[model samples]
Target chain A: MRTRWIFGTILMLTLVMGCAKKKIETYPAGVSSNQQIGAQTKPYVTNHQEEQTLSSVQEQQGQTVEEQNLQEEKLKQAQQEKEDIRKIIAKRIFFDFDSYELKPEARKILQQKAEILKKHPEIKIVIEGHCDERGTEEYNLALGEKRARAAYEFLILLGVDANRMQIVSYGEEDPLDPRHCEAAWAKNRRDEFKIISSK
Target chain B: MKKFLLFSLIIGLFGVDFGWAKPLRVTIYGPAESKIYVFVAEPINLDGKKNSIMVQEVVQCIKVKLKLFPFFKQLSPKDILEQGKINDVARIDYKKFFLSRADIVITIGERYLPDTGKTRIELRTFDVFKQKMILGKAFDLTNQRQVVLMVRKYLGDLLQLIMGNKAFFVNPIVFVHKGIKKSSIYQIFADGFGLKKLADIQGIVLSPSWSFDGEKIVFSVIQHEQHKLGILDLKTGNMQFKKLPGNSCISPVFTPWGDIAVSLDFSGSPDIYLLDKQLKIEKALVKHWGIDISPCFDQSGSKMVFTSSRLGNPHIFLFNLHNNQVERITYEGNYNTSAVISPDGRLIVFSRLTPEGHRIFVHDLKTGQEKQITFGPGNDEEPFVSSDGYFVVFTSNRSGKYKLYYTTINGDGPYLIPTNNISTFSPSWSWVEEKYF
Candidate 1:
C-alpha cells in the first residue's frame, strides 16, 4: 500500500510539470522593441506638460495590473506580425482638445502613413480612436469616433481605398498618457494604427 | 375590518377611473405649492401579522409612495407622541405640530379575511381645523401587491382633490451603473427604495431608454467581447442582440411613435439613424460631417433636437420633421449638448460647458431664455426631465464619483441620489402620452 501511494504522487507531479513546460513553449518570453516608441513626441504639439507619456511604461517598476494587461495585449498582437511589418504602419496621429480636424503637422505625419498603406495594398489596418479623460465617457466616445473618421476620410482623400481600413473608438478607455494633467490629456487624445491582416 | 373591505370594493368598482379617458394613463394635474401637513397614525393589527412578509411588503410600499408626495410633511406617530400629543378626534391643537400649521391627519388599518382570503385596507383622512372626517375609504384587496397599487391610485385621486392636479407618481427611473471593468443598467424608485439590478453585463452599458408601456428597454451595450443593441424583455429575462453596421453606436432614444433612433458611425462618421424595433436601420435621420448625436424626439414625435459639430463646436440643433428644416436651437453657448424636450414641448433642459464647469440649464423654447440649474464644482452632464417637466434628473460626479441627482424645474434641491456605489449615468425619465393604449 505504501509503495502504491508513492507511485501515485510521482505521476501527479509529472502531469503538472508537463503542463507548465507546454505553456512556456507556446508564449514568447518578452516582446522587445528595436526602436524606442516611448520617446516619440507628437509633431503637432509644440509644448510638453505631462510628467511622463504612457509609452515610457517599461521604466515604471510598479505598474498597475490594468496597464500591464493592456501592454500584454498590445505586445502579443504586435509579436504576431513581422518586425518590418510593424515599422511601416506604426505611426499615429494626435488631436487637439475636442477637435477632430487634422492639424498641419498631423497632415505631414498622415502623408507618411498614407504612403505606407499605398505600398502595402495587401495589408488591412484598424484606425483606433482614443481620447483624454476630461469629459464624460459616452461623449468622449463620440468625440473619438469623429477623430478617427477625420483620419479615415483624410486617408481616403490621399487615394487609399476606404475598404483597406476599419475604424474603432476606444473613447477614453485606453489612454496613451493616463494622468490628470493637461499635458497628459493632450498626449492621450490620439489615433493609433494597427495592422489587422497582411496577406 | 369589514368597513375596510367595503371602501376598497366601491373604489375598485365605480370610482377608480371616474374622469380619466383611459384606465392605464392619467393626465397631469396642477400641483399646489403650499406644504401639506399630514400625520400618519400607526397601522393597526401589528400583533396579528407581526412577522409576515405580506404585511411588511404592503407597509414598505406605502412608505415609499408617501415620501415622494410633493410638499408632503409626514409626521410619524413617534413624532407626534414626542410632542406629547395624541391623535384625539377632537381638541387637537395646531401648536403640537413643529410647524405652526396643520392640514390633515391620515390613519391606516389592515385586516385579513379568511373566508374570501382577501386583505382589507382602511385609509382615513381628517381635517385638523374642522375636526371632522374629510375622506374615509375601505379597500378589499385580493393580494398585498394589489393593495399597494390601489393605495397609489387612491392617493393620486386625493392629490388631485387637494392640489387641483392629478400627476403620475410611483414611476421607476432607469440608469446605467458603471463598475470597475464592466457596467450594467439598473432601476430604482423615485423615492430611493426598491433597487433592483436588472442585469450584470460584460461591457459598458449606455443610455437605457424605456419603451412606451414600460415592458422592455432599448439600450446600447458595447462589449466587442459580447454586445447588444440589446432589446431586453423585462418580464422573461430574454434578449435579442442586433449588430447594426457601425464601428461604434450609442445614445438610443425611443420616439413617442415607437421607432428607435440612435447615433451610429456607419458612413465613416457618427450620424443619427432611425431603427425599427428589431434594430434594422430604417433610414438615416441626419447626415453631417462632424459628430451628430443625442437625438431627442418631441412629445408629438414630429421634431428632433440633437448635438452637432458642423460649426466646429458642439451645439444643440432643432430638426423639424415635416419641412426637413434644421435650425440651431442654442447659439449662446459654444458647447451645449444632451438636450431632452419636455413632454409638453415648451421647455428644454441640457448641459453647457462653462469656465466654472459643466452646469445644467433649462431653456424655455417660447421665451428664448436659458437659466443655469446647477452651480456646484463637479461637472454635471446629461440632464433629463420627468413626465410633467417639474423635476430634472441628471448625472453628477460631485460626490467623488458619478451618481444620479434630481432637482426641481426651478432648481430647488440638487439632492444626491444615493446608490450602493457611484456608477449611475445618462438618466432618462419615462414620458407619458395623452392618448393611452
Candidate 2:
C-alpha cells in the first residue's frame, strides 16, 4: 500500500511541474510566473503550440538544421540589397548666386561622380542646374544655363562624351527643397546629376 | 383650267409669307434709355498756317508708326469746328444730335502760336446731351513733326478718361536683347514692330524696368567687375548709375520717384531691399536668410510680389508694406518661381514645374485660379506680361533651342523674336509711354 501511494504522488508531482512549464511558456517570453491570468491572458499560446508541434516534427524528420540555414542566407541577401541602396549617396553640387563657376567643393563632388561615370561608361547622365529664387525669370534662366554648362564642361573634362551627356537648366523653376527656410534654400541652390540610363 | 388658275392666284395673294422670319432682336434696352454715346469728330487746327499735315496725313503717319493702334476714321477739319459749335459745345439739340446718335462728341483742336513757336493742340471733350464741355486740355509743341506724337498722346489720355481705364494705345514694352548678345535694351511696339534699341550699355545688361514716366529705364549692368543699377534716359542717351555695396546685384526694379527695389545678397541670401534715391539701403522687405528675389512693386507701390523660400518651399509671396505681413500665393506645385504680377494686381504670371515639365502659369488673384500657359514638347518659363496686359514675353526651348518668345495673354502660340539661341530668359516688358497710353 505504501509503495503504491509513493508512485502515485511522484507521478502527480511530475505532471504538475510539466504543466507549470507549459503554462509559463504559454504566458509569453517576458511574463512572470506569479502574474495573474484570465484578464492578462496573451495570444502567444498559438506560437507556443506551433513551437511544440515544430519540435515534435523536428524529432520525427530532423530537417530544421538545413531550413534554418537557408533562411539565414535569405536574410543576409536582403540586408545586402538595403546596404547597396544606401551606398549610392546622391552628390549635389552648388554655384555662387547667379554664377555658374564651379567651386572647389563642387569639383570634389564631381570628381567622385566622374569616377562613377568612368566605372560605368554604359550609363547616361543628365546634369540639371538650379538657382535659388532670385533675379528675373529670364535672368535666372540664363544663370541656370551657365550652371548646366559648367557641370557639363567638368564631366566632359573627365572623359564623359558630349553625346552621352545632356544638360538642362531648371533655372529657379525646380527646387529640391520647397521650404521658405535656410535649409530648403541651401538644398535648392544646387546642380544635381541624374543617371538617366544605367547598366 | 382657267377657273383653277384664277382660284390659285386668289389663294397665293392671301398666303402666309416665311421670308419675314428673321432673328428676333433681344431688346435688352428695355424702357431704360442708353445714357453714354461715343462720337468721333473731325480734327481742327485753330492756330492756322496749318502746323499739322492734313487729317488724312496725320492719321496715316500714326498708323504707320504704330501698326497696333487701330486706324482712325477721319472727318474734315472744317466740319469739326462747325460740329463743335452746333452739335457739341452748344445747346442739347436733343432731336438733332440724338438723331445723329451723338451723346458724347470728341473735338480735336490743333493750335500753333507764332510767337511761342509751340503747337497748342487742344482736345475738347463734350457731353452733348448734358450740353457740357468736359475737358479742353492743350499740349504745346514746336513743329508739325510732333503732330503725330502729340495726337497719339492726347488721344490716349482722352480714351483713358472716357473709358475709366488704361487706353490700349499707351502701353509699350521694353526688353533686353541678349541673343544678339550685346548689352543693349530694345523697345518694341505692342504688335512687335517698331523695334528700337533704347540703350546700348558696354557690359552685360539685364532686367530692364521702366521709370514712373515710362521715359526712363533702370537696369542692372555688370561692368568693370562691379554691378551697377543705372537709370537710362529713353529720349536722351544720359545715364546715371546707382552705386551698390557689392558686386552681387542681379535684378534692379524701380519704385515711385527715384527709389529702387532691388535684390541684394550683402546679408548672405538674396533679399528685397529698398534703396533710396541716393542708393542707400532704406529697409529690408524680408527677414529670411533664404532667397527673397524678384521683387515687383504693385501698381499702388504699397505691396510687392516676390519669391520667398521662408515656408520651406520656393513659392511666390505677397509682402504688404502697410501690414508688413507676408502671404503665400501658390500651393499647387512643389516649385513655383519667376512670378510677375500684373499692373492691376489681379493676376500673376509664374513658372510651375510639374511631372511633364516646367510650364508658364497665370494665376488669377481674385479666384486663386491657376492655368497653364505653355503646352509644348520642351520646357517653357520666364513669363513677362506686356504693358497693356494683352500679351506676355517668355523663354521657350520648344524649338530645340532656348530663345525669346512672346504670346498673347490668352496663351496663344508664341512669336519668336529675332534673338538667336543665346539661352535668353527673364524678359520684362517696358512701360508704355504717354503716347501709347
Candidate 3:
C-alpha cells in the first residue's frame, strides 16, 4: 500500500508539472488560449475530488505523450525557425548614389536571397528603401522607393511571389551606417527587408 | 507687472493685429517715387546714450529687412556726414542724402521720456528726390522687442510707398533644418530675424505646406521605424498627426477649399488621395499602377501638378479637376519633380535632374520655354513660388551641404538665405498682403 501510494503521488505531481510546462511550449498559441478559456469557464473544481481527478489526469497524460511529443517537436521546430529568421537573413541590398539600378553584385546577392525566399513561400516581407544624404528629401524618398521597387521587381522576376513583397521609402532619413562617407553613403542607399510573418 | 502686461498687450495687439494670418500695414506714410534708395543714419539715443544698445539693435534689424526689398537699397548717412561736416541730428541735412546717392534718407532718433520712462522712437524717411519726409512716426516703446518689430512695420509701409507694392518685411518664413537626430521645422521673420523652432519632429520632415489659410503646416515625417503625416497649428501650438489609410503618406498639400491632397500607399503603390479635414479619404485622386507623388494645387484650386512614373521615369504631370484629365507637363527631363504653380497661376517652377546635378527650372505655361535658374556645384530641389510669385525659394547643396536659397523666377539667382550653415530644405513662402485695419 505504501509503494503504490508513493508512486501515485509522484505520478500525480508529474502530471501537474507536465501540463503546466506544456501550456508554455512557446507557441502553436492555441493550447494556451484554449486553457485560458477553460480556466475561466470552470474556475476551480471541488478540491475534495483531487485524488480522483489526479488519477484521471495521469491516465490522460500517459495516453497523450506519443501524440503530444510530435506536436511538441513541431513547436520546437517553429521556435527554431523563429530564431533562424532572427539570426540568418541577409536582408539588406545596397545601391549606388542617385541610382536605383541594382548593381551586378547586388543582383548576385539577390539571386541567393531569391532562392531562400522561394523555399519559404509562407514568409511575407517589407522592403524599406533608404537613401544617402543627397538631393531634396522628397525626391530622395521617391528614389528610395524606386530602389525598393527595383529590388522587389527583380525578386518577382526571380519567381518570388508579388503578394509576399511590400516596400516603403524613408528617403535620406534613415541611414544604415549614418556616416557621411562614400562607403557609408553606399551602405545607406539600399533596401532592407523585414519579415512580416512566417505563417 | 502692470508695465509688463501693458507692454505684452501692445506686442500682442501688434501680433494679433496680423493674427499670424497675414500682416497688416502699420504706419501711415506719404506717397513717393517708384524707387526708394534708403540711407539709414545711425540712431541717436537721448539722455546721453542710455538706450544706445536699443537703438543699435533696431538699426541692424532694419538692415536685414532692406535685403529682401527688390527695389530698396541701403545708404550710409555717416558717409554723407563725413563728406560734409553735419553732426546735427535735428537739423535738416537733405543735400547730404542726394550727395550720398540716396533717394530716401532714413534717420532714427530715440529720446527717453522720464515722465513715462519709456523710449520714444522718432523714425523719419525723407525722400531725397522729392526733397521731403515721406514717413515720420513717433512710437513710445516700453520694451526693445516691440521697438524692433515696430520699426519693421514702418519699413513695410515705407516699401509700399517706394515700390507701389506691399511686401512682408516682417513676415515669417517656415523651413526645415536637419538637426542632430532628425530634421526640425523652423520659423523666422522674412528678413531672417526672430528665429523660432516650430516643431522638432525627430526624423525627416519634408515638403512642408501651409494650410489654405496659412495657420497650420502639413509635412511628411519619415522616422526609422515608421512614417507619419503631421499637421501643426501655429495658433494653438498643437501638432496632430493625421492617420491615413495606408502605410506611408508623403507630399501633403492643401486645396483652396481646405481639402488635403496627399500621396500614400493604400494599394501597395504610392498614389495621390484627397482627404477631408478629418483625414478621411475623400477620393483616390490619382490611382496608378506605379508611383504618383507630390501633388500641388494650383492657384485656381481646380488643377494639380504632380510627379508620376507611369512613363517609365519620374516626371511632372498636370491633372485637371473638372474633366479628371491627366496630362504630362514636362517632356525634357527623365526625372523632374516638385512642381508648384506661381501664385498668379501663370508659370510653373520645379527641379530637374541632370548630369551636373539637380537644378531648379521655371517653365512658362504660355510660352513653353524652360529656364534653368540654378547651375553646378550642388543639387537644388524643392522650389516653391513666393506668394507674390516674383521669386522662389528652394533647398540647395551648392555649398556642399544643404541651405535655403531664393531667386527670381527668371533664374536670376541662387542667393543664399543667410541662415546658419546647416541642412535646410523645403522652404514654403507665405506672402501676406498688407492691410491697414
Pick by lDDT: which candidate is best? 3
Q: Candidate 2 regions off by >4 Å?
A: A1-199, B1-168, B179-181, B224-226, B354-358, B376-379, B386-390, B395-409, B412-425, B432-437
Report, for every candidate in turn, its global Cα lDDT versus the true structure: 0.70, 0.62, 0.72
Ten residues in sequence with the least summed lDDT for candidate 1 chain B: B21-30
**Cα deviation of B19, candidate 2, in Å:** 36
lDDT of 2 by residue, A1-199 (tens): 9999999999999999999887876665675666646536654446767999888997756666676777788888866743443233257887765456799988887777777677667767767767775444534644564576678788889887767776655555567876645577667778877667765
Q: What global local distance difference test value does model 1 have?
A: 0.70
- For model 1, the docking class works out as incorrect
The regions of model 1 sitting more than 4 angstroms off are A1-81, A84-91, A136-138, A173-179, B1-33, B39-70, B73-99, B108-121, B127-169, B179-182, B225-228, B277-280, B432-437
In candidate 3, position B368 carries an lDDT of 77
- Model 2, TM vs. native: 0.48
lDDT of 2 by residue, B1-437 (tens): 11111101121122222232111111111232123444555466554445356444554554443333222223333333345343323333444444554555655555566786554555555555545555455556555555555555555554444433342445656666553334767665444435566666766676777776677778876554345677887667698876576334656788755578887655644577888877789998776765677777767777778886666556888888889998889998767877887777777888777666678888777777777768755767777776555456777777766677766555655667654334454566755454432
RMSD of each: 21.7, 26.7, 14.8
DockQ ranking from best to worst? Answer: 3, 1, 2
